[model samples]
Target: MLGRGSMLVSSLFPLGVSGRRAGVLALLVWALVACRRAPEVSSDEVGEESSPAVLTIDAMDNEQHVLRGGFSVEAGVFRVELYEGSVLLGEALLEEGRWSIPWQPGVGSEFLEVVAYAMAGTEIRTRLDFQRLSFTEPEGLYAAEALLALPTEPDITTRYTLDGTAPGPSSPVYTTPLVLLNKRGQPAPLSLIPTNPDTSPETWRWKPPATPPVLATVVRLQRFSGETPVGPAEARTYLIGQGATSLPVLSLVTDAEHFFGHDQGIYVPGRMHDPSPEGTAGWGTGNYMQDGKEWERPVHVEWFEETGAPVFAQNAGVRIHGSGSAALPQKSLRLYAKEDYGPESFQADFFPGHPLRDFKRLLVRTSGQDQQNSKLKDCVLQGLLRETRLALQACRPTVVFLNGEYWGLHEVRERYDEYSLASHHGLNRKKVVILEGDGLLDTGEAEDAIPYAELLAYVREHDLSVPEHFAHVEARIDVEDFIDYHVAQLYFGNEDWPENNIKFWRHRGGSATPGAGDGRWRWLMYDLDAAFARGAEANSLGRLLRDERMAEPFVVLFRGLMTSPGFRERFVARFHWHLDNTFAPERVLARLDATVELLAPEMPQHIARWRYPESEASWRDEVQRLRDTLARRPEVMRRLLQEELGSP
Candidate 1:
């Protein structure tokens, strides 16, 4: 979006142009702009302007120095010049009706421009037509080496930066093929205090690590004509020599100012910071806690497969994600693909075999509440319920980098929003209504909360023990979907639920269409970081059945539904079916082991960077604890369920 007119004279500056006029410089700017518009040639030198010359580039041979093209005017003699960026690639005179230049493009040249000039009595008559040629190469992950080349022209020069900052006038000029090397070194040491020694408590907070910079090379460059930039700045990230891992890798590059600047930075405690009193534990208010459009920053996103093959490279908008997690040293980031940034959606098959490929938004999560415990807990727990009818975020573990700094292990997950609902259930995004907790609408219009409110009121007032009353509730929501959702949460023992982290969605068109449009609400499963927090013998079923601290609507509906034998029968049947299958000890353990194995290689570095678990030993203990919890949960849950409603 940077405009060519605002380009700095020294070299290319990336586009996305926005500027304000200064009152004092307005007159001087107008005079200079008027002069710049004046013709460089006079009437006496070029005789008289008649017909304009047309230039076209037909084909560019990769192996030969034959650039073939055509010209529009056959009567007047004209000469054509081909350029890459201040580098004259080739030149030739027009012959008959066509022209050929004796030049070959560079090995990796991605773009080139051509211009034709008319001639009369040895003086240049007028600058005529111009054309450009572009090429796209197969881009993905790379292991060995990657070479990048930029086209050159006589008046245009290209400047580049390797630190992820936007190229400016003073940036290094692109002289030769830029080479990227793998320099991934050992992980940094743990930064910790001696007080809490057991396992790093999730309540304990810390400052951002001053670890070493990221090893991957992020190259950003732009071309300039005089003081004006030719086009938008381009960027690429190369992961040379970095060995393969079982998980994917994401490289996010942006200017350091965007993250650490006092006035505009989104990652730092800036001018707006209001810290809590000393010795007290609080996330504290800071610029990072701010939300909405102004806090969103521009970033370049690059996704690499497990084998170091590239997936997709694009420019996107990024914002600090989550409520309390945003204040963490290793915070979560929400990536957006808006038209203002670049693409409307990330056009790639990020998750293979999954029906949905293109994602409107994604989250680079730092394991949320489990960041200090086993980082793989949430993702692994979600994986166990993949076969359930509830809508769950797709979780994929990945290593991440920010502004060429190794940000440690993070999960690239699908975000819960209207777009995701549309993609997953084939519903119109505009017609979807998602509500969280009681009756708060997460998506759709304010009026969308009405249906959920009505359902909550009817369940709270009427007796669901009556067959007609229970049947009415079923008509308003996907009863089976709701059961599966609560069952999974209960099985996981997610202590953060019932009152918080609740989400349900329904299509507005309701009953007008099939599937999602049946006007029946469905639940979403997310934020299970608090799951399995208690030991294996924790009685989650008993807690939900007798606990009074839960939200009114959730408590009333659940307890009311249990009053009916029909509803109780179905809930008990579904819960046991999941225990026999989804929570099967072997199946759950196999998934846990596989997830741990995937993260084992990167844990040392992530631990050192965040000092989360304090040591690899602590992390392993937590993983073992999780394994033990899964092993005993089914039996304990079954016994608890029997005590509440007798034998199934």
Candidate 2:
């Protein structure tokens, strides 16, 4: 169940408390200086040898840097002063017996000092000492870029960093540059790509295993009967991870209970169920998209049902009587058969500095086909003022959302007067819900997916609610809960769903930008099949959320609407564009084409199973709808498709 990247606890840095050291020392000096004001404070009272509080900082991980360490005294009207060198930067009050400050280094190495003293009528009590802290960004330095293979072998280049810098000469560089191609893309000529790299402490090399992994070693541990057992009945069964397993994925579901199977992780077949077999593919009331009618049976998808779920090797010793199920010879279970799964730690699809740890708050998702090329959707979400209020009212400190586009928090006030989905909030003030952008192109682009310049602008705006769109929860005041869009793939290829989704989230008033740049550069970006050339890149659902770069307020409600599961946004332009392009009976299916576009790259191996009767039925129904719509106007489908799809 663990995919490409594996999550390892990996390593830690020292907690530096030097600042505390300086603070305590300064306070001693101050007490000595104020001879008359000094209130009988002796070093022997606190059982210390006139030493100040000491502070030390260590980073076990880059994400969890800040630490809550110092000891606080009783509430007193005392002035606590802090200094680095000659700079008398700031002072704080000891009001509620708590003091906290974030560490942000400027220029070179930093040393902090704190001075504390009591007010009139109050005597000095025990004081805290010095602290030492160190800071570093391991992941930042280790992050490497990989190149996906091209139909025509891409010219290899050597460069360092992903900071929008162009590739430089492979020579004159002291470091060895690495290039990569996926297992599927490994042709005979360029098969030297790193599949598996040995990752150790000094130099971590992350490479896929060369041979099949010995999945979890089966171990029978404990037994259960009626939730508890006087005796033994069935032993607990589990498969540990050694290498990797290639099991048929029956179905899959997500929840906080299982950590994707590593520690009660959630990825196994038979575990993933549609509930009704014909039930909805996702959560919520079934009529999420279709207007008047609710779907009786959930759309049957192949990958979702086949290779998406997990499979477990369960209670193997429980001998099943052949044929009959009425009764069986029950035996006592082996109570103390605890089998070790090799290692205490294993792998799940966990992200480094993972989000979604707090799964209770709001977990929203987007479903565009990356048709648009801006971060408007992200900004529109950050602009939600009422959301902050609602979250605060629920007793939750701050609100959170799966950031869709790449913009700031200004639009909440700008657009709400006209189309506010939120009810109980006045102007001028809103709660500060933490916004962490996780999905799609949160930042710059790469390869076939080049981030549009428009996305960069929306991301740059500081007046917006979210400061940035490329991050998820890491700060305390940030979102309380962090969740991901498990069913994000549903947004693709649904006639106008992607458009409708953006429209709904954005409040739907603004118009979409025309993606046309004349038909001259036919094979420029997307896979347009013009008379000049034909192309299809790895366009998927990710590009869907990235396409929210519409003009303001429109992107507002559009973001909010898509936060829901209904997915009502429709792509009128793309639908019309396809029609104008003289799309044949087969090519007229935008829904099908879009679905194919989204699923094809990731699901090339499973496309054969997608040819079920239900899928064909959906295709035919959509095809007829297209044909009949076109039959009504002047080559409606053809003209529109040719005009838009053919444009740059």
Top TM-score prediction, candidate number: 1
Candidate 2 versus truth, CA RMSD in Å, comes to 30.5
TM-scores for the candidates:
0.75, 0.18
Instruction: Go through the candidates in order and give each one's C-alpha lDDT.
Output: 0.72, 0.22
343-365 per-residue lDDT for model 1 (tens digits): 88987767766688899999999
RMSD values for the candidates in order, in angstroms, are: 19.7, 30.5
Best by lDDT: 1
Tens digits of lDDT, candidate 2, 124-235: 3322222221111111101111211111112322222111111133212212211211112112211112211122111212222232211111111122222332222111
